[model samples]
Target: MEFRRPGPTPTPWSYWLIRLLFKFVLKIFYGTIVVENTHLIPEDGFPCIVCANHSNSLTDALLLVTSIPSKKRKMLRLTAKSTQFGKKTFTSWLIENAGTVPIQRKRDFEGQEVDNTEVMHHLMKALEVGDAVCLFPEGFSRYHPTIAPFKTGVARLVSDVLSKNRSHSDFKISILTCSITYMHRQHFRSDVLVTFHEPMVFTPKDNPELLKPVDYNVIRDLTAQMHQQISHGTLDSPSWGLVRTSKLAARIYAPLGTRMSLGDHVRVVRTFLDAFKTVRKKRDQSLVQQEDDQHNIDPSFISELETDLKAYQDQLEKCGIKDDRIRREILPRRTIIYRMILRLTWASFLLIISMPGLLLSLPVYVVTFYAVRNFKKTGPVFDTYDEIAQYKLIYGLISGVAVWVIGVLATLPFVLITSLLIPALMWMTLRWIEDAVSSFRSFTALGRLFLIGKDTLKEMYDQRKELHGRIMDMAIALDLPANPEEYFAQAGGKQKGRVQGLWESKAKYFSIRRRRKRDWNETLRLYDKVDYPDDDSEI
Candidate 1:
């Protein structure tokens, strides 16, 4: 009688315990996990390949595994480097207990080269038994904004699986494209966007021989699509205030708050996508007007449009949204619910975090104002380094004074109980100042350089607003809508009516607005008035 090793057990209790632990840790970390298209996962036992772009840090696998629904969870396994298992007992336990298959990357194992053949065999065996295997085609994590080229292992594995079961060739291996995105990966309370593209069929025709040469192209196209969907889907339909608020939350309050719920994460992503689309639309409209004015559209216009179109195309491909039926059914519903939930959750979280900071920072805020004023005036007397050092000095002084004042106020009978509040306030005030200065310097060095006096800049901004108001009045008098929003909308609507005349109305709208602003400036002699001080000094 021959003895054979039994197949990997379901480990129901282990999986449930792991999941419970995952929930507890997520709560503790305040981590948010968003999973898109959970329905795509087959409920019945089916062989499937889970391929995701790796971009997050090491804990990405944890995030992915934990977010998977419980029913299908035990059937999943990951491919990990053998070296990780060799060095650490804990890592080895994690790999084995988590059902990870170890593969050597560079060295030979037991007289065989570190080729993926054995790994592919193990994966295929697992698949034959209806297991879901997770693999990062890129092999490792990479930076955002671009995806690395995919290794050929995935293509090879699919090819082998099809070849082994010729009659069952229609065995239907579902290839799922997954993407995990982060606001700031290492930071606590950061939002994650997990998007799932519909399952793709890896028919025999999509074999290694045919695909190897063009595999990169296929992966690139797919990965780009995933990035755009995950990236833009997160941003769709957010108000400007909400967008700004979310960004602020990610930076400050995000660190302090608990991890966002899956629903909240989806909402943040949708808000971002909506904002991106709005900005892109505005940009396109402006470019169209510029092209019509020049009487010849620039080649660069087409290039930019092509880029944006490609992004959208790629996104569609990954989400398997290319199926018109699925898109029509899923997208609208998901978008509406996601937006509502995000707005409420985000607003609540921001209010909770910011309220205490606001109340506590009040007294220290007075000191911060004085420090800012002094820092602005002292810039002319110091170079960049000197100015920064002096600014730090002023900050320390203010913080010290605020601390002392808070301590004294706490000593009062009613205030003593409240004195604990002062420490938090002081901390928040200093942090806000640091963040503001850092952001200000990054956005414009001139902000720091010209910090000699900001009153002049304030006056200039007021003058510009006045000029813009006068231009709007002129536009209304010229029979255009008084509001830019109404003017653009009407123009767009009219342009849509005439396919051949698309963009002509938008061109005319902007031309009228631009000409009006110019006329208003001339009428007010604004430039001449502002130039006088400089001219007088030269004279």
Candidate 2:
């Protein structure tokens, strides 16, 4: 089915303002937000139902609203819980104006009669106007690596629309499925990938009787199809442990000395997971396939790879080293020293200029930091890791705005100048902090060069190289692409890294790594045991 590419659509000033704020917040929150296949979003089509797997709470919706690029920004009428409405707060006002469609759930309002017929009408009205309507088919947000069971809301919407418009000769609608993947959800400044998959078209005008009633079976089947489409764009593993292991394997499998974009990282991880699933399925079912088959994989090879990876991880932890540090291009002692000095010098200069702003911004920064830090202690218990970031975002925004307003009023005589200068200073202060942290890490890594014995460093290097070469060989034997970065780049994906020259490589090596600084407790929390099977679990 062909979908007409969406052109500029008229959007309200309020929606655009909100979207602008969302874009700014997302940019600050995530180090990089890469959007892929934006062409698949039918922004100007007949009743478009956009569905996404709700994995990261409000952040998922915000990404959908702001990440995708379009010639004309189309306001996505989000379907939110009815409980979210009927409030006099800022959130309610924001959602109300942002074109949110509220659906009533009986569980939310106990002993009170709730109806969604009106909600359905509101959604239908919005769609009939050629507006894109987005809803999380999974119903609620989750931190699980896999998609949740769909709530049938999406299926019912599609079926109802198609059924209602069956008589119109030119009637049609498109369902755009999206998937959001986060490298590290709880941490700030991590990478996020938003993938918009091809749209599925439903044309009841050609065959009126082809439309089915929105019954249990029909909704279930449609939801399953939607789930499959969204799943295609996600990295689904049995548990977080498998996810981490797969990422580790991907890092080792990737070409040495090459930095991968998060998109490539996720794709490579999926490649490993796909191989694991295939090998495990064959082993569990006792399937006998010819060795010449392209899909055929050796179970022993995969087992050995996993075992070696675990050992490599243990070794790195024991050595207090990171995989990136080991695989990074080695530089001479003088070059390292110069680079360290340069970074430290730049950091010191930045800190001097940023001190005044940092002090002025200190109250807001410290309050937001400590508030979010002690949130779980004083606030309600968080259910998922995803909630942490969302809370931080909300707290930061509210506190920042509130504090800025108060500061401006207190210094009314210089309101105009201070208001403009304060925000810029705050921004400068944030950049300085990031640079300071990066410089500190570079300094530490450089200092370690002088402290570590040459023999021990060489041994660690040799072990890592051996493991990396073995993974490369196994990947080749399995007929996986040798260079994933190039493969993705060839497919029109953009990656950020230094080019192939000695000086350029050194510059890229010193570039700030976006990896989260994990303490011992954070590490333990991440690798906590989950009692799930190794096999792929159904969504």
Candidate 3:
């Protein structure tokens, strides 16, 4: 591939083609991808900067590059650490072609963007030309779950851009905050939920505030907003266990029969976190005004409602059942049968169309997978968990390309007649196979739920209902709707569990199958009343 840099103007055709390729490649890696509020991107020739949390390294950039519509690819520019592109290797070449501009992570002094003027210039130039510059304000990706403190560079860079573009009255640049959540960060073929928050705009007028010669108050304020917004995007607790438990709790609190995946579960939490704030704000306003209307909600009401929801989630965690099993335990028998029949029908069609491609790709993928397992022994140099997935994808991509070339060479003489035909056929079929395999796994899991016996299912369902009844009692006291669906309807902003889930990737599943196969019965027993008495005092 030819190397190219995105300039002040739009990139050439080759740059966008590789970006398109990236779109397809990433989709293959992540089986279930949910991108929300993408329509918020305005392409009206206004300067834009996408400020997102940095966590997953190159995969983060790849996701942002492909998340928007293909038409917007020409205007997208991604930020990379200078070290990533210093060498002229194939990966570096790919980054250059993908419209990356490097920022120096280290400055002579901490908390200063005083150095790296050229890097600043490139970012400013992109914004000046009505292009969208993507940046991770945190400066570097942290391997941990928490969002790192944003470096002062983003605020400084935006302040500088506003000052430089003062002459254009019609020009306005917007910083879009994107929050990306992965169900299993290091795990391959995990689910991803990319949510785009509203944009923050800066006109020429804001420049004077930033241009103050002495105090950096304006910069500090901007950085604070960035920190808050990015933090909203990240899911963090003291440890991964809390994060995992919180994730499962969110799914349980979601609407029944939705079968929400961990990624979607996180999105629900993100959406409700904002909604919870809104409800509180409204409640506070009512309290201060002492509204005469009988329907007016008291602030204490929402407070209790929040507390009850927490208790409900805590009790479910104490029950030790996953969201999928919970759904199966309570769903109507007819609905369960319908889903099984539908999944079986779909699986048969997938098998017929996808078997050949699966055969073609399996051998190369197997060899590459084992090869990269050795590299994992060195462990991750960075704190990132995505190293394993990255290597697998990189090596798998090479194997794919090599095999395709071999296929072309072998099809010689007839190659011209079938070049486009063969490649297109293989790509579609291979993708179908991947999708089919994932769905089959999910189907099998659902089937096993039925096999767990009516006695066990009833026991689990009774436990869930007992906890849910307590939540309803609290809801009734708060003078709010008791049903989960009804409460969601009244919230009136985002309804979670909107998207149905997809199956997990087989290659990734097999890698950690044992851990996932942990005895749920034993887990439940550990949480049983025999182990620890509940508030009811039963053992």
Candidate 4:
């Protein structure tokens, strides 16, 4: 049975209550979300479908639905697998009340086929009422940056909606394109960027009841168009490690007063790959052809890049740090030691104060580490790193509740105060550790970069300077932006940090880091205000 509310729309009270709660939950754990062109999002009281690339698991769907403008959230309906709605619980109740519709998309148990006619009926009903539907045309989450083959479900939905609105003199249905990417998906508190591309509009054909001969072709063409638009917003990486290495080298070579914001880091890495491709296409046209056919950027480029960065990568490893810290802090600074001391001092103080909470959460921490460390589910479809992040969150929340319950039991008379303190302290403790580690790691590396009299470290910096100088020369020759300060001043960036860094002879890969303060000369505003088109100009 399909789950539907008593009426056309979900109760506004229930909808916003859970929507805000879940949205807050994701924000607390998943990290910062940056949305581009939010004004382009279609308004409520219009029939529309929001199509997006699926990268992270359930989080992907949540992000698309939650991150839209608040007023339109109530009108949004997510098309979910039918199986999930069968169970009656808080999750199901919440989803159904959030205006979700179940689609029996394929074969079910006992080899029986699902009845799509019912699904289509419910969807058509939703469209008649001007509710916007959100669907992932791709059935599941992709493990990488590349978009998978798109399913034609969205096209069918658009056609069916058009058919139902045949009686109206003016028919309008819009498909909005949304593309999102995760900078560090496997890490908690990482960043996400969501871009809402322009919408595709459809008008009724000449005949209301009969279908147009070209409609099928139009649907197929539209599917292809959506795929292309969504892919453009995706973060394509031939080699994440190589990309990170290039940023490190970029920092060494970039002009003075150069600082890149997080967005700027993304722009730089993407620009590098794009530039690399354009350059390599001259040397080998066939490799470029394969890349154009949806193969990742030529693997040969990453191989050559790794070879070029070998020495610098090794030196960074020895310092027990990453290239990001040097690029983010040291390179931009006329002075470094003073900032390092203050950061170190602050981190130590935080650690001392957070111990009470840390000690209480120790048991949960041990379990989290054990579960994450022993995770050995390697298979063709497995993504280990992202899965690890998922587990940390699941375990952390459950254990947190357990700790609070224990606190309640221990302090019966003062249960309310004690219980609050236990969870509060534990949350602060975990958050503190995550932050302190980044600062202290950089502090240790600063010592090696400046204070430690190590020959290898000195040689590494020297090599870095020379390579960076060459990169600057190349950028100038190509007429590219070679200075981060100027480039970021113009508003551009990319994600940069420790990727699969160089082979560390002395230790495991150091933790990844990004500067909290972005190096932007000017704020990059997200959108220009726009007035909605009038009835005649809707198209």
Question: For each candidate, what is the lDDT?
Answer: 0.46, 0.67, 0.59, 0.60
Rate residue 159 of model 4 by lDDT.
Answer: 75
Q: Which ten residues in a row have the lowest lDDT in candidate 3?
A: 517-526
- Write model 2 residue lDDT over 78-194, tens digit each, in one string: 777777788987667777777777877776889999888888987876666677888898777766676778888777777777777666657677888987887676565656778
| Runs with alpha carbons beyond 4 Å of true place in candidate 3 | 1-8, 70-73, 107-114, 165-171, 186-188, 233-236, 255-265, 271-322, 326-355, 380-382, 416-458, 470-482, 485-539
- Candidate 4 at 453: error in angstroms? 4.7
Q: For candidate 1, lDDT tens digit of each residue in 1-539? A: 22222344365565455446544444323223446677777543667777776654235566667767767546567777676675544435555667678877653356665666677788888876667788877665543223455666665666567666544434656677776655434332334556676776665445434233344565545555544543443432223333332332221111111122333333433432333344445465674333322223333443343343334333323422121211122224345445545544544454455566656555544665565566556533112212222233234344555665767675787686556556555444433332333233222322222332344334433533443454334233334344433333243222121122347534643221111111000111111111111212211
Q: Per-candidate TM vs. native?
A: 0.45, 0.81, 0.69, 0.72
RMSD of each: 19.7, 5.8, 9.8, 11.0
| Candidates sorted by TM-score, best first | 2, 4, 3, 1
Residue-wise lDDT of candidate 3 within 168-210, one digit each (tens)?
5555778888888865654444557787888888776655676
lDDT (Cα, tens digit) per residue for candidate 4, span 1-539: 22222233544677677567656555656545667777887677667789998766556767776788877545577777676686864446666777677877553445776677887788777766667788887765556544678888888777777765665646667889987867666555666678889988775654332233335666777788999888666655443544445555444544322233444455455555555545355445555334323324444543455457656765665555554444443442325677688779977987898889877878777876787677734533334443554556556555656777877898999987986777667656655665576567557666555654445444555666666665565455445575655555455333322222245311432222322322211111111111111223211
Clashes of each: 21, 0, 0, 12
Q: Specify the highest-lDDT model's number.
A: 2
TM-score of model number 2: 0.81
Clashing pairs in 2: none
The TM-score leader among the candidates is 2
The count of residue-pair clashes in candidate 1 stands at: 21
User: What C-alpha lDDT does candidate 4 achieve relative to the native structure?
Assistant: 0.60
